[model samples]
Target: MNREFIKKLCEETHACVRILEGPIGTNDRIVLISAKEEPDLEISPAMDAFLRVFKHVNDISYGTGGSTDQIAAYFTACSVWLLVASQQAINLIGKQGSSIKSIQESTDATIRVISGA
Candidate 1:
């Protein structure tokens, strides 16, 4: 919720994405091997949150009460979460007077548009 928390969350999210996406070649292979060797690989807080969201979406999408409206709402919630996370990341980085102005601007605009909707 705070700036520091958001910054850490963004970093973790990026790490989790990279690990899941798997880069090319030896480094990728090492990460995979390490993951397998250490079954209890540490999951970042952000990734944990994402997994929870994913579970909820899956449950809602497949449960007995599933409906078109519910599925739509779930996806909408996911989009909002993503936008908020991105906005927080941009804010945290911008506070240091970094040079990613275009990314920050675009993220702000997307958040605003989604919030307006």
Candidate 2:
């Protein structure tokens, strides 16, 4: 994995991530800034995928106990993961007209694989 890339993401978003802790569940469970760190800033699907990844609203979570910037940074980091996740989906699509659900599942599988889930 690209440690620097993840670190850069956290730096820009002002958050930190501990890979060993890993995602709570789902092959593509995204905490956005990720649950990797306690987000302290506002996070959206553009900047994260908590809601996007989790179909259940009550299941998607955002941090509530840290600096706003920290939360933003954390989301930013998760955004980075989302970025990577998107890339994976794109790759899975390749030249084939793949189904959206299939692409999502493929990318989600990749996220957990890369995140040490």
Off by over 4 Å in 2: 21-117
Q: What is the lDDT for 64 in model 1?
A: 29
RMSD of 1: 16.4
Model 2 clash count equals 8
What tens digits encode model 1's per-residue C-alpha lDDT throughout 20-65?
A: 3333553321111111123365764444445534444356533523
Note the Cα lDDT for every prediction shown.
0.41, 0.43
List model 2 lDDT by residue over 1-117, tens digit each: 246755655565454433444456755533434434434546632334333222223332344433334344433233334435755756645555455546557545323224323
Q: Which ranges in model 1 have alpha carbons more than 4 Å from their true place?
A: 1-42, 58-78, 82-90, 93-109, 113-117
Indicate the worst ten consecutive residues by lDDT in candidate 2.
51-60
Clashes (backbone N, CA, C under 3 Å), per candidate, total 0, 8
Model 1, residue 98: distance off in Å is 6.1
